[model samples]
Each structure stands twice: as structure tokens, then as C-alpha cells.
Target: MNDVKAAVLYAKDDIRVEEMSVPSLEPHEILVKVKATGICGSDLPRVLGDAAHHYPLVLGHEFSGVVEKIGIGVSRVKVGDRVAGVPLKPCFKCHDCASGNFAQCKYYSFIGSRVNGSWAEYVAIPEINALPFDESISFEEAAFVEPSAVALHALQLIQFQGGEHVAILGGGNIGLLTLQWVKILGAREVTVFDIDDERLETARALGADHTINAKNANVDEDWKTITKGKGFAVVLETAGSDVTMRQSFDISANKAKVCFVGTPVRDLTFTPKQFEQLNRKEFTLTGSWMSYSAPFPGNEWELTLHFLKLGRLNFKALIDRTFPLDNINEAFDLYRKPGSVKGKIMMLND
Candidate 1:
């Protein structure tokens, strides 16, 4: 492969579009020509702050591509297949991976973090990580499979049968995606809380029963009334702020399932009230990491494709904007603005 164009992160706040060498394949690998990728909220901190596990990285894993080449013995997908991929490549010798809990593998590596990733013309991934989709799905929608699957996996951790009141504590991408899943899973009522009125409105259009602007409203009193003082049967905290992380426990019901899906901006600890909710209400809190499971790639990816194909999940509506890879700096500035409800800024290959 010749040198390919990429957005490379040389250091914190130092990303530039440059040509880099394309990756070589291993026996189990496939070289994908990246078609589309989405700049994740996590990408901001990692590229602008200190979240990169390593520097000079090509920082994007939420991408869709077409297979250009394959390595020896690779038969999961062939050349020209349109695909979305899981970013993880876990060392199977680890006890956790051997037991089917791939997410907890002792020696796990990631595309954007541990290795170069999809912010380029091409990326090499394991055949298992490259999931093929039919022509019915667009690369834009396929690029979203990773994030959508993340939201789906978080819901998978809960035990909601259906017809339960669930409150999503953030209206970001994950929050909104989880909101759709809650409604699809048959929640009697799904309320979304966010400081962004625009995101709340978006959530409303996407099927949330109600929206609360935490910046202006009293979440405690309103949440009680919203749930008829029964509290929410399930709560998802995707905001990642210190206050919202604490609020996830505060508004939970007795025996409710609470999932923290956001990457915390600071240390998350259980304070008096949060601890009291844990003690008094008997809350079950599940911390969801990158989505994956036994046979690799996980159920989330499978179900996301099914829902996307059936029109149950709308990937296009969640996209607020798009940019060519060259304008990544401008995209980053726009995304960091106060109250910006940028769903997901799609980065396109020129």
C-alpha cells in the first residue's frame, strides 16, 4: 500500500492532516479503505486534552469502510465488502477473554488508543472486527454502528422487561441513542434531562415523553412528579459531569437499575445522598465499557444493524453536521461551544 492521507494527532491539541503509511495485515487481518468516520465526544478530550494512550495516533474508531485486501486465511469477509468494525483486539490468552468476557480482557488493545485507527484513508483490523453489511445500509449509518451498539450494550446490562419508566440523564449522542432503545424496548415513559434545550427538543422528536433542562429546572422535584414519586425504574447517566454522575443515583427508584454510560470528566464517587440511594433504595449500578462479548464483536453490533435496517433507529436524525477531514480543527472548536447539541460531526473522506 502507498502512503495514505490521515488526520494524525502529534500531541495534545496538535492534530494535522498528513500522509502516513498504510498498515500491513496479519494472518487474521483485513485492510479497510475508510469511507466515513464520526468524531466522537471522547475524541475532543483525547486530541485536545490528554486522553490519548499514545501520541502521533490516528484517532477515530467509529468508522465504516470497504475491504481492499485481506491476509492469509482470512475468510470472514472478502474484498469490496462494505463494513463497520469493532475497535478492540483482545489477547485471548487472558483469563477474562478465555471466559467470554472480552471487554474485561487483561491485555486488550484499542484502535484509536493502543494502535493507529480510522482517521485515515485505510486501517487494518481483525476479520472478526470487520462486520459486513449489505448495500441497504449507507456507510454513514454503518459508521454509527459502534456508538449505537455502545448505547444498546448499556441497555443490555439492565433487566427491564418492558413498560417501566426510564429517565435518561443526558441528551448527548449516547443519551439520545439510549433514549430510542428505551422507547423501543417498551418503556412506559422515557424522560430525558439535559442542560441543552436543543438536545432536549431533539430527544422529544426522537420519542422521549418529556425533557428537563437541568440548567433551569429543579430535577429533584420534577423527577418525583414525572415518575409520580415512584422514581424511575431505570436511569442512565451519560453526561459524565460530576453533578450528573451524582444525580444518577439520587433520582433512582427502589431496586432500580442505573447505568453510567458517560466517561466521567472527573473522579466519580458516591457521596452522602448518592450513597444513601445505594443503601436505601437498593440500586444496581452497572458500569458499561466498550461493547464486545464472547464470539467477539458482541450482540450490540448485531442488534444495531437489525434495528437500523428495520428503520426502528434513525441514524441520520442524530447527525447535526458534517465536515471534510481537512476541517477537523474547525469541527473541534464548534463542538466545544457551550450548550452545543452537535449530535455527531461526520468526517468525510475527500
Candidate 2:
């Protein structure tokens, strides 16, 4: 068995680079040489003792790679094909999957969460998890597909009408990516809120019509003024802050849709008045989790690729930093610091 170097999380704030055996491929699996992996905010809980799960696990889910070996019965891709994967593994036979709601499948599993993921030099994955990358897309840019898909999924849940206004409650990667998707879906205006002024500037560059620095300004007054006192048609909460979640109610128009795309910890509480307001105003409240099953109907991986191919997405602007695999601890440290920029920590195999 070949040995591969990986950053494994043993417990809270405990991660180390270690050598492990390369995973064996099943008949339906394919071996991939991971080229790039992006760190996510979700991984912070696992690192900070906030998330409830076992450790000594590989934790990267946003990744892109080249196909190295195809297990028996694999024909969709051959050796040396560039690809990106959707980490979700849904039970295709479930009723939810049959109805195009794979995210609701009873037995859903995801790579890098419940299973080993792409932090290693190589990963053995099922063919279904893999999506072909067009020749025009680079591995670095393709790494954005997973997060972009997630933002796209959130937009789908809201079912926003064309020319409607949207307010996104974060200027992080997901928030910025969602802004791009909202523009693609014909939203009349996209306003983004962030505590960091740098991130707010980044949001503006990424097509946001307006930006709010919550640290220095009042979010409610600013949002009301931006929407001309009617509030926005859609409010997306991606900051995962209890304060942001609470403020979501203040910025939503009557009959507006609110989508919670961020996963806040359990300690955050909501007031009964919020639900009552939702009921009285006929507000639609929904949550979007990870991506699931085939064709990914509403998401924008296809569209993101198109934007990338046409040089419209501007992924370079979003990439704040990159780190070698050996410096992963430094990367995580940077992530924990306040005022970190939007986009990802690219892990390169040296």
C-alpha cells in the first residue's frame, strides 16, 4: 500500500500531518489525485469543540482533482480526466430522491463530514460523486464549485422571482457566491451585510448593489433605506450569527422569503415573536443544507463553469490566500482570526 500524507484532526484544536495508507477502491469507486482543496467555515466547529462528532478525521470537502485509476465498472471517466465532486452520497432509491428532493433523503451521507475527505494526496470516491470538469476550468477555480453549488441551492429554496430584491447577511464566500447567483437569476438588487469593511468592499466588487458594515452602522435602518422602507423580497442569512438571524426578521418584506444557509451553534436562541411575525406577515422561512443527487437542478455549478469559461466570475479576486499541505496548521490559525477575507484557503500538494 502506498503511503499518503494528510492533515488529520484528532480532537479539538488538535491536528497533525501524518502518513496513512492510500484508500483501496471498490468496484464502483475511482482513485483521484487531489490537486486542490478549500477550507470552509463549517470546519471551524469541528476544530473548536463546538460540533458533536468523532475526530482523527480528514476534513476537506471542497476539492478538485485528476482521475488516476478507475475501478471495475467505471466508464464515465478515464485516467487523467480533471473533475470536481459533489461530496453528498444520497440513497437514490429513497422517496425523496425519486421526487427530486435528494437533500431530504432519509439516509444521506457526505464526504469530509461523516466520511474521510480530500485533505489527503489521493481520495477514492464513488463515480457518482464525481462531476466532469470542462477543459476550460482550472483546478483552483473548480474548487469553488462545491461552495457555489451550496449558494445556488439556497437561492433555489427561496424561489425568488425575477427582478425581486435580495439582502444577503454575510460577505463570506457563500454570501458572495449567492450574490452572483442572485444576479444570474435576475434579482433587481443585491445588498450584502458584513462586519468587516474589507469583505463588504469585496462584495461590492462581486456585483452587490449595496453593502452594509454592521459593525459601524445600523443594519435595520440601512436595509430599510436601501429597500425604500418596503424591505427586501428575499433575505438570506449566511453569517450564522445569532444577531444576524435575529435581524433577518427586520429586513424582510411582508410575504418575503427568508433562507437560512448558515449553521449556527445550538446556543443561539430565537424569540417567539419572530415566529409570530413570520406567521402574521406570511413570511416563508426555510433552511438549506448540503448538496445532494444528480443534475442538481437549481444550483449553479453549470452556470458557475459558464461564468468561469467566459471570464465573468472573477474567482481570482475571491482567493484570499493559499497554503502548502505542510502548513495546514497555519492555515487554520489564519481562518480563526477575525477579519479574514472571503474565499478559501487553497491547500496545494507539494
Candidate 3:
């Protein structure tokens, strides 16, 4: 195996770029020379102690690359194809996978989290996981497929029927992307809340009907005032904070469905009053994990790619910065900076 450079996480705030043996490919795998990879919100926690099964792990899953090598029997893609890949590896013979619910598969491994990921110059992935992109699409745009898949997948859980008034908590990238989906999917109006007004403006620019600065204003009062006490028909809790989670319960219309898309860093609590709101509203609460569903990796991945390829889901506005692999440490610092610019930050293979 050749030597490759990768960013490995040793522990909380302890990521280092060092030389490592290149990953070997299985008979059904293809080796990809990563061209671009984007940082993810979940990546932050794992890099800072919200770790997975192991440390000393290469930490990037949202990426696009050119095929470099192929193992024997890999026919799905050949060398030099530009592609984006799914990080979820499902054992296809499993009952869950057979039924097309890869997320429910008993035997599933997540790349970047369970194994090595794309922070390196090269990564070995299953042939099925590698998807060739249109020549018109840049690797930078392809790198966004993963996160955009996540945003779209959350909406699939509710299978939005349109004409619903929506409320999204958290004006992060996922939240912003979700707001666009709501408008496109037929929500009459969408109101987004974020602690940062700057981020809220980003959301509004992306087509949110209204944006709320939750930190400076009373979320309930503002929600009631704008909603005329009717509340939202669909509530998406993407902030993961106890405050946003509880507010999701408070501001939801009766019989509304609330999907919790954010992974909480700490235990969240709800007061008796909050519990009463749930009881009174009778909202359906659901948790949205990673964006894969069935037929192995799921429709979320396909849906994201289809829209991105068609240019319907324009994420160009989401990219704010790019850095080389060597400066990945600086990339993470900016990501963690308070009130950092609201857009995607990427690591180039160069």
C-alpha cells in the first residue's frame, strides 16, 4: 500500500494530519482520491469527545472524489470517474436491507464514524457506495450531497402533503436547507428561529417566510403573534438545545408532527408545563437519524442527488470557505468560532 496523508482524531481537540498506509480495497470496493470534503455539524462533537466506537479515526464523510484504483470484481465504476459516495455500508442480505430500510439494518457500518473516512487523500469504498456525478457538477457541489441528503431525509419522515404552515428551530445549514424544501414541498408559509439573527438572515435569504431571532425575542410570543395563536402544522426541531426542543412542543399546532433532527450534545429536559403542552396538542413526535432509508442506502440519497443534479436544490449559497487538508485544524477552529459565517466550509485534497 502507498502512504497517504489523513487527518486523524486522537481525542477531544486532538486531530493531527500524518502519514498513514493507504486503505486497501476489497474485491467489491473502489479506491477514490478525494477531491473535496466538507465539514459537518456532527463532526464537531466527535472531534471534541462525542466520539464514536473508536478514536484515531479519519473524520470526514461528506466528500466527492475521482476514482484512482479498483479492486477485482468492481464493475460499477472505473478509474477517473468523479463521484460522491454514501458513507452508510449496509449488508444487503440482512432483513432490513432486503426490505429497503437500510437504516434499520442490524448490521450496518458508517464510514468516517465506524471506519476511515474522506479527510485523507484516498479512501476505499464499496462500488455500490460510489456514485458518478454529471460532468457539469463540480466536486465542491458534489461534496454537499451528503448534508443535503440529510436535510431532505428529515422531510421524508413526514412525507409532507403540502399547504402546511411550518416552523423550523435552528437556522443552521440543515435548517436552512429544510426551510427551502418546505417552501418547495408546498408549505403555505415557513417561520424559522435561530439564536443568531445573522443566521436567521441567511435562512430568510433562502426563502423562509419569516425569521425569528429566538435569543432576543420571546419565541412563544413571537410565534403566537405571527401565527395568531394557531401555531405550526409541522415543527422541525433542528437546534438540539433543550430550549428549542421544548419550544417545538410549545409552538406546535394540535395534532402536528414534530421531527427531531438534531443530535443533542447533552440531556434535555422538559418542564411539567412543556409536558402539558404535548398532552394538550397531541403532537406526533419522531426522531430522525441519518438520512438513509431502504433499497440499501435509501431514497434520501437518491432524492438529494436528483434535485442537486437538476439544479433544483441550489446549495451554492451554502458554501462560505475552503481550506486545504493541511489547514483542516484551522477549518475546525472557524467552524467552532462564535458567530462564524453561515455557510459550508470545505477541505480540498490539494
Candidate 4:
């Protein structure tokens, strides 16, 4: 086989386009020809050497592709099928996996993080990870299934009742998608807060009942005014900022449920007095790591496809730009800019 082109990251600010041997498949694996790969927040840490990662890594997990070949044991899909996958591989025998918590499994591996990912012409993944895409779903939209699943899992964690008011602490892709889920789940009001005016405007376009410019305005006071002093029934902290996490408590109503979905780069410190106040107020605090057990409607991929087919989810609006594989560095640079709200920068295969 001819060598395939891939964008590999070596260290901080070091990434290259090179030819690498396309992986030979194991009996339980499948080879996929990558079509569209989306840049994620997690990719930044890996590129900057801030996160623990294996060097010379192919750095993309959010992706959609076409099936190139199937390994011996694969019967679920055939060559030429359009697909997307959750890049997690778990040891099903582990205690966490046994209980249906795959993300918490002891021997969990994630693509782009622990293994070669989609920033290449081809990638080999386990047969179990790949899901067939519906005919109507574009590859670009399919790349969003992973983050959308994260949003869906966050909503599942909160379990908000119908008519409850919810507050989202970011207007990025995850926050915007969660806003749609909140509306689908019947929230009476959804308020989105962001520091960027353009993102705030996008939130309004996406059906947020209110949008607050956190940089210019006092977030807690703005939220308080919007809620008419009642506070919100649920608060989702997707901004991944220590300030936002702390502010979540200040704006939540008594007995409100708070869900933290974003991963912060730095360790956060909370005082005992804060817990005491939360306990006194009967607030329910929880963290949603990632999706684990929720089976897709027909299959996990089918649920994403169904949502897209029914016109319930709009990922097209979320994608702001596309770059060729050779220009991966420029894409990452765009991602690092302050006040950037452009969702899902993609690398297209030529």
C-alpha cells in the first residue's frame, strides 16, 4: 500500500504533514478513509504539551469518514459506508464498564488522546466504535455527533423537569448544542452567557430566551434580573473557567441542580464554607464527564442521524471554517484566538 498523508504533532507548537504507512487492520478492527475531522478543545493541550500525551500523535477525534475495508470479524458494516465513531475504547470487564460507565473504566483509551486519530488520510479503529451515517447527514455534520453526545449526556445528568429554567455559562459549540437539548427536553426558559458579543448574538439566534455579555455586565446580576429574582432551576457550567464555576453557585436557585460539563485546565479550589452554603440551600451538584451507557435510538449513530434527519439539530450553522490537512497549524492558531466562537473548525481531505 502507498503511504498515506497525515498531520502529526510532535511537541508544543510542533506539527507536521508527513507520509505514514496506513495501519494494517487487526481481526476486530476496521479501516476508515477519513473525510472530515473537527478540531476540539482537547486537541490544544495535546499540541501544547500541557496534557499528558504520547508524542508523534495524529490529533483529531471529532470526525466522519468512509469505510475503506473491514477486518475479518467485522459484519456490522461494509466498504463504502459513511460513518462516524466515538473514539473511546474500554475494557468491558472492568468494574466501571460492568456497571455501564465506560468513561470511568480502568483501561480506557481515547482516540487522538491515546491512539492515532483522524488527522490523517486513514485511521484504523475497532469495529465496535464505528457507526453508519444516515444518507441525509453530511460528513461535516456527522463530525459533530461526538460533542453533541457530550451535550446530551450533560442534559441527562441534570434531569431537569419540564418548565424549569436553565442557564448555560457559555455560547460555544457545546453550550449552543446543550441549548437545543434543553429546549427539546421542554425547558420553559434557557439563558446563555458569554464574554463575546458575536457568540451572544449566535445564542440568541439559536433560541436562547436571554443572552448576557458576561465581560461587560455582571453575570449574576443579569441572570438575577432575567429570572426575576427567582434564580435558575438548573445551571450548566460549560465555560470551563474557575470564575464561572464559582458564579454558578451564586446564580442558582435554592435546590437547583448544577452540572459541570467543561474540563478546566487548572485545578480549582473551593472553600468549605461554600459547601456549607450549598448544603444549607439544598443545591444538587454534579459533574458529567462524558457519555457512557445511553444507547443511540436505533444505535448510537442512528440517534444522531435521526435527530439530523428530523431537522431537530443544526450542526451546519455551528461550523465556521474549513482547512486542508496541510494547513492544520493555521487552524489550531485560529482556535486559540480570544473571543473566537466559530464552532468546529474542520480539516477536509482532498
* The candidate that achieves the highest TM-score relative to the unseen native structure: 1
Name every residue pair that clashes in candidate 1: none
**Candidate 1, residues 2-58: lDDT per residue as tens digits?**
798989999988889998888999998999998889988888889878888887889
lDDT of residue 34 for candidate 1: 88
lDDT of each: 0.87, 0.81, 0.85, 0.83
lDDT of 3 by residue, 27-78 (tens): 9999999999988887887885666568779988999999999999988899
Q: On residues 1-350, what C-alpha lDDT tens digit does candidate 2 reach at each position?
A: 57988888888888889998887899989988899898888887887664626677888888999998999999888898898877877777888888878778789777787778888898888987787877788888898888888888787666666688899998888888888888877999999988888888888888899999887656678878899999888999998888888888878899999999988875776679875778777889899886543565334567666777887676667788988888988987776776564567788764
Please give each candidate's TM-score. 0.96, 0.93, 0.95, 0.95
C-alpha lDDT of residue 245 in model 3: 90
Looking at candidate 1, what is the lDDT of residue 274?
58
- Model 3 misplacement above 4 A: none
Pairing residues by index, what is the TM-score of model 3? Answer: 0.95
Q: Candidate 3, which ten residues in sequence have the lowest lDDT sum?
A: 293-302
Select the stronger candidate by TM-score from 1 and 2.
Answer: 1
Question: Which residue pairs collide, candidate 2?
Answer: none
In the range 1-350, model 4's lDDT, one tens digit per residue, is 79999998887778999999988999989999998999887777778655737787887888889999999989988999998867888888877787777778789888878899999999998888888876788889888988888887777767665589999998888899889888877999999988888877888888899998887757667787899998888999997888788878878899899999988877887788765758777889899887656342113345556787789988887888999998988887775676563677888996
Which regions of candidate 2 fall more than 4 Å away from where they truly are?
50-52, 293-299
> Cα RMSD (Å) per model?
1.4, 2.0, 1.6, 1.8
